[model samples]
Target: MQCPQIVEPEKSTQARRHALWSTCSPPHQRNSPMATTCPARARVPLTLQRSHVCQCVFIRSPARVGAVVSRAEASTAERRKTAVNMRTPRRRRHRSLTATAAATAAIAALSTSAVAPALASDQPPVNIVEMTPELTKKMQHEVDTFFAKHDLPGLSVAVVTPARAGSDPVITTFVAGTPTLGSSELVDATTQFELGSETKVFTADLLAYLVATDRVSLDDPVQLFAPAGVEVPEWTDPQTGATTAITLGDLATHQAGLLDAPPNLGAGCGADPGCENPRPGYTQTMLWDAFAQPCLNGQPCPMYQPGTDWLYSDWGFGLLGTILANVLDPVIETEPPAYQSALDQAFLDALGMSSTELEFHGDGRLATPYKADGTNAFHWDNTNAISGAGGLISDATDMGTWVAAHLGYVPSTAPIGVQAMADTLQPISDITMSCSIPDQCGPAHFQMGLGWELHHAATHDVGAAWAFKNGLTDGSSTDTALAPSLRVGVTTMYNKRLSDTDQGLPLAITLLKLLVADQPAPEPAPSAAPQAALAESGQPTAELIVPGMMAAGFVAIGLLLIIRRRGHGRRSTR
Candidate 1:
């Protein structure tokens, strides 16, 4: 069993970097037989467990001791299984060490026989399933399996696929569990869930409708649409002394450099952001007050150069929605305009989204919202001026139809005569996010479209793109994604609030990956260190690596046992 000693170079950086000997052999045999070709030249096909860090496998063979088989070389079946079964993370950001540990344990709980799949260089054409009875059952199965594993209150899933020849587009809906824990009432396709920020998509669509109708332009300054004598503050560069007015487009694309929420909200919440009733008390007058407070007297209202950076601002969208409302009818009184009703008459009703409302209907169909700890959560009512930002309550059916309209599937009853729907999806800003929280920034960056966030395929590489949005409220979480190229859309709604990683985005993206078989390889998720922008928009971080390390370890052990048995057989035959 004595192996030749391998001498180390005094300071060979390249050798050190490429050395696998440390783990490949005992201390006495620091030389990995992999460093050089084996004289035996036998391709023994050694298999090791998958490694999440590397996203590949190392083969230990008699002839080639350390050959690497990348994710691309692995079987497609394994790839599909891993993609479908990956654990969902609670948040959108990169995972923390504790979250990573929890994810690791979850993955370890999976059947030990499962193998981790690699990101294949060339993915097969996405298998877009047609909406059929059989597909409905399959989709139901996926939904059921997920609910069985999680302790959430309820879920409703909707998927729309391109129709077969001579048929309309196929639509399927799946509902699971009850609206509340231990409730006899069950969730259905029509069960309503708060849309959260997905309402931003609707708000953006409304803006597009106005633009298409020639009521306003994207480049028009916000002050132009504001009520007379109300000021929507603009950024004045102190260094250059040049003043730039915020535009409707800037607000829509989150480039307005506004606060995430207006300052009045802080004053209402006593500066504690986690307060449940922070926004319901906010009104149009408060919004106007926020707009008017900038650079007054000695108060400093510093804004980054508007249109220069991307920041998520509920305050900006609230302002944008208010402006759009004023476009419909100029606000003459001090009272808040009925913006939500105006929005419905203007477009939501036109789009046949009858189930969607800015306020709770007090009906049984609306699922009760629950916090993560299963406590009843205060329902958010955005009936005030800020309704456009996170106001709408919707169900799988209505939201699915809304998504269908985005993909040119608008029914005759609810037609978008102008090109406004398409305009809402045009990329307005390039998103480049930096991670300051260690291990919490994911590789997903976005291009801001009016109300939508766009996830494109690999960077600098041409492939399909998905327009998606994640919505969260105190009680509910929802995710919506659509691939226009494939004419496929998915919406996942949950009754109780889930962590960013554990929310519906992972499930929705997983379903998208299943239906869109040809989706490009996902961009590599960033590590704990500060990293550059995504090279390609891949699957969300939740889908790719969470279970990989644990599954790979199991796979490696199984492969070793097989290798040992085969070796004994060869010796006996010889």
Candidate 2:
């Protein structure tokens, strides 16, 4: 009879052949026999008696197969099954894992890119001459003691020196206390605080710019800038009753015979009430009305001729700001801009003081001004309209840059040279104000510069006849000084009110001494171009001294490896 066609499935057929070959082998010699027989069966089934032979192979192999044959077939089938399983689901899992790993790697890279350097912690080690660790610690301790004694909320101090070619200027900064009592934020190098009368330095610089451009002269009379129909205050010689005019130089040096406040302070307000309107929100119309008023009942007329005596006057400085604004307009030709805009453009911008500004409101990083009692009830006075004299907000970091410029260690935006900065710090007039009695003024203990006060003979141990200024409002006090004798500069800002004679002056003296006592002797003047280049570049010398950038790179690389391993783990799961 014709054999029924044996349509063995390919997988089963192969398994049967494997089993048959394994059974024919001796138990002890199974490996050699099975290998030879399996190939012979494979050839015969495909070539001759294909249908019947294939059917017989499947049936006979299963019955007579050795224990080893069954085991071999089982093993082969299991391996094939495993391979199939591995190809489908396993392949999909591996692909999913690869995608996850790639995504994780990408996210890690993005995170690294987004993170900025920790500016506070990453400050390069500056080479401040003689700033030994011991001295730094002692200085910080003294500062802390002073703060506690004076009940101040916060303070910052910086010392900068001239830079030599290929070397960074020495800088040592110390910060103390919280920026505000109610917050956990520590004072950083960048905390913006009110600058008070320290603003005058920038104003004086603006005037220098005007002078450089020939827009205004130092000797120009005040009447030249006052608004039309505004009667200039008559300055009668105390003995002669003869009127004298004040010049721009007189205003700049506080020798303009201007009062401490606007004349309207007593007229519109009341007698001895001048302080009441110290920062009144006076408009242009109000200023005009106030200027028109006659001298008060008991108030003395101009005591000294313009350019004869040096007296402090915010009004004179305010008028200077207005004149600067007007002079700058013909050159810049813009409308409705602040009087200080010229200063911002001509000086602050060129100095890379990106954070300094004439006004600060709504900026969260700003240190809150506090009264002596630590209450935030005071607001900075904005009524000056003439903001150049006492309206600036700045951080220690930016002030450091300003100090560098003053030291001639950095270039200024103005065309004025080192001699010009020196001129600003020179003694313009001998200050003869009484220390104890009002009219019993003594010989000059202080002198006036263009916009600075010269301590020709400071009463403090640390200070050495420095160029200085101090500013105070209701709850803010600031002092900035350049000790040329020591080649050091310092700035201190506090958000609390203290007596001018007590807390403010003493602190200034102490900081000046701390900075001067430890400074190294000045090196000879460096080559001009190289020093100028360093100043112009403003790159911190610490960058070259510290390996911070290298360390950051290594950290970034380790982060990548960790991210990669996490991705591999996720991929394996898939």
Highest lDDT: give the candidate number.
1
Model 1: which ten-residue window has the lowest total lDDT? 47-56
lDDT (Cα, 0-100) at 61 in candidate 2? 33
lDDT for model 1, please.
Answer: 0.61
Provide the TM-score for each candidate, comma-separated: 0.62, 0.61
With a 3 Å backbone cut-off (N, CA, C), the pairs that clash in candidate 2 are 23-66, 97-571, 462-513
Instruction: Report the C-alpha displacement of residue 186, candidate 1, in angstroms.
Output: 0.6
Kindly state the number of residue pairs that clash in model 2.
3
Score residue 50 of candidate 2 by CA lDDT: 11
Off by over 4 Å in 1: 1-129, 132-138, 266-275, 292-302, 331-333, 411-419, 433-445, 459-463, 500-505, 518-574
* Candidate 2 lDDT tens digits, 215-325: 678888777876667776657766877887877778788877666666664333334443443343544444445556543344543445777666677767876776676
Candidate 2: residue 208 lDDT (0-100): 67
